[model samples]
Target: MSLSAFLSARYGRGFRDRAQIEAHHARAFALFRQRVMPRSPFYRDLAQVPLAALPRMSKARLMENFSAINTCGIRYDQALDVALRAEESRDFSPMIGKVAVGLSTGTSGQRGLFLSTPRERALWAAIMLGRFWPSLARRQRVAFFMRADNALYRRLSNPLVRFQFFDMLTPWQDHLSRLEALDPTVVIAPARILGQLALAGPRIAPQRLISVAETLLPEDRAAITAAFGVPVDEVYQATEGVLAMTCRAGSLHLNEGWLRVERDVIDPATGAFCPIIHDFTRESLPILNYRLDDVLVPDPAPCPCGCASLRIARIEGREDDMLWWPGRAGLRLVPADAIRTMIACLPLRLRDWRAIQRGNVLEIWLDGAEGDAERPLRDALADLGRRLDCTPPELRLHAGLPPEPDAKRRRVRVLPA
Candidate 1:
């Protein structure tokens, strides 16, 4: 794909007319379907099939049928072996021939492996520069933090774009001096790690801040923004593909020009959707109607920036995090956003918090910078019970931080059935 042509098609022209944007995406989708459908044996039956009629794909299904589903013809066992070995060795330079292989964090039980060829890597870099970087002409420094390193990101380094990869697994203090010395123009990291960085209050504030991997909480955003003197922008990407990104107005919008997003609506009243992605740019590992379990809230009104892409107000927690309880009628799943909002409204300040639903008991963990969070915690539970219209589950307050910074911090989680 030509970098100039791609950027000009989307950003330069500013496809502000909704119908025009839709027309552009429809053409791209048609081209993608024509090229990709015939190559894979798995999708042979899906040739000329309607997108909705094509069978839905999940992580488990993807992993189980990697060899067949992937057009690149990489074996599942071979890919898993290399990915696992790299994770253990902490050396991510290895690849499946020209394709870069990386493993998911496995916050869910089943871990996943993703592949990207050199061509795909270059395309990703070009698209990222167009979307996130302030300008193509100016030189910029970037510090990217993540658990696993990919060759796709390393390819971003150039004279114009000086990119540094910080390993999240390493001790945060080890890189403090480097961060100070680099004094990056833009900082990208997980929301949890960004909050930890905010506490340090580094002298060199970044002009742009981007949060990825985890859900960017309001409190976390406030803390980071206060420390850096810049509003936090979010990139809602997954192992699946680069999905949505924050606009100039700081509103998160799906990259509809490159990817088609279908709303698998779970809650009609709240307008919450589980995103089903169809990425035209992904040729090696074609992602079509690949559904994600995470819940996202869609904004009905147009954004102030007037970008015609699909607008997402906020990303709620994952589907597994949504607490389900047996109500008078049937099993009811508590809205993750409601649970978070209720906790955030508490009278006392919470340094960090988490609620885990194990069977009928709701175990609460609250870390307060101040003294005695017990009273406030109890009050929050009382309010939560009233909102859900169910008997309060046995509330267990753990001694330590709600979710220790060392691990994946989930606001809501339900034990496996």
Candidate 2:
């Protein structure tokens, strides 16, 4: 599927002209407004305000009124039941089928259920193929890192594409074993996990590497590409759906055809935003003008890749992952990625560390050799604390930091449970 052909089929002739993207967006928004207003009482009431007068709906508001948001007959409680059942059965196709329901992994304490129509799913699949592998016409094997395999994967009929699911919940060693056997052409996993794999060295050589389901740290990106000898692309997908993806040039481009992303700037000091997203692809549960807590900065300049869609320089990690440490006045939340960045600058002697917040104290655990290992790590931690204007908390040393059951290693965690 060539980009031009895919866009023409999906958006008609207007897609070729750059100005028509906004025009297409306006048309899709109007159609979404009409379909959702009558079928979904939740959206009807919320969207009652004039299109020009509608206030931004925040994440808190969406969660509060989740049940009423869906146009489908299924209530919020019912959707939860259906989603859980589908996940447990590992046969999500029947529950989703022509409908698209992707459950949030719930790492941030709030799990969300997103619903999309068959048209949306097809469009999504087409866009993904068009963006990622437009050059490949022959059959290509893809190793997908997913928590649960869904029917959507089973039903995809592209003779040139074969997808193999690699469960994220399994141990890394086990997944590596499976990857060795599959010998897939493409590898996709979370950025942190991909970094770990790179550190372990490559057992399989894949032509393409993709990171999804989490933010891709700058350090991780370099490591993955160096290990695989291939440029690593990022798919900015979440429980909400596929939001954006990187082009061949490694620039992040918005999925403009399916969703309208309105960016809200964060205070440089606070680093928080209320993102308003209008999901044109969602009809079963219309997420019209829905606000997200995730923070992002829209790129002002055109991408070097020459894609017409909007670009984002970075997709900062989740809001909940922000670190809160005690100060003289009270507790303060700081961007956790900053700590990770600082640690990346230090020598490789300090292999891994995890931050845990308990009461007024933040504990930093260092996992590496004993002598002088703690010194550089502690200095780096203190420097980060000083830069963030917060006093450094307790620092400790450990033989090893246990991995989360889900196979994700958290750089920052809330403690005192």
Error of 1 at 407 (Å): 4.5
lDDT (CA) per prediction: 0.80, 0.67
User: lDDT score of model 1?
Assistant: 0.80
| Candidate 2 TM-score, C-alpha based | 0.82
| Model 2, C-alpha of 221: deviation from truth (Å) | 1.7
Backbone clash numbers for all candidates listed: 0, 0
Model 1 misplacement above 4 A: 5-10, 325-333, 369-372, 387-391, 402-407
Choose the strongest candidate by TM-score. 1
User: Which runs of model 2 end up more than 4 angstroms from their true locations?
Assistant: 1-24, 45-67, 153-157, 170-178, 199-203, 269-274, 297-301, 307-310, 324-334, 385-399, 402-408, 414-417
Task: Please give, for residues 87-152, the per-residue lDDT of candidate 1 as tens digits.
Answer: 899898889889988888556756888889888888878767766776566898999999888898
Error of 1 at 10 (Å): 8.5
Please give me the total number of clashing residue pairs in predicted model 2: 0
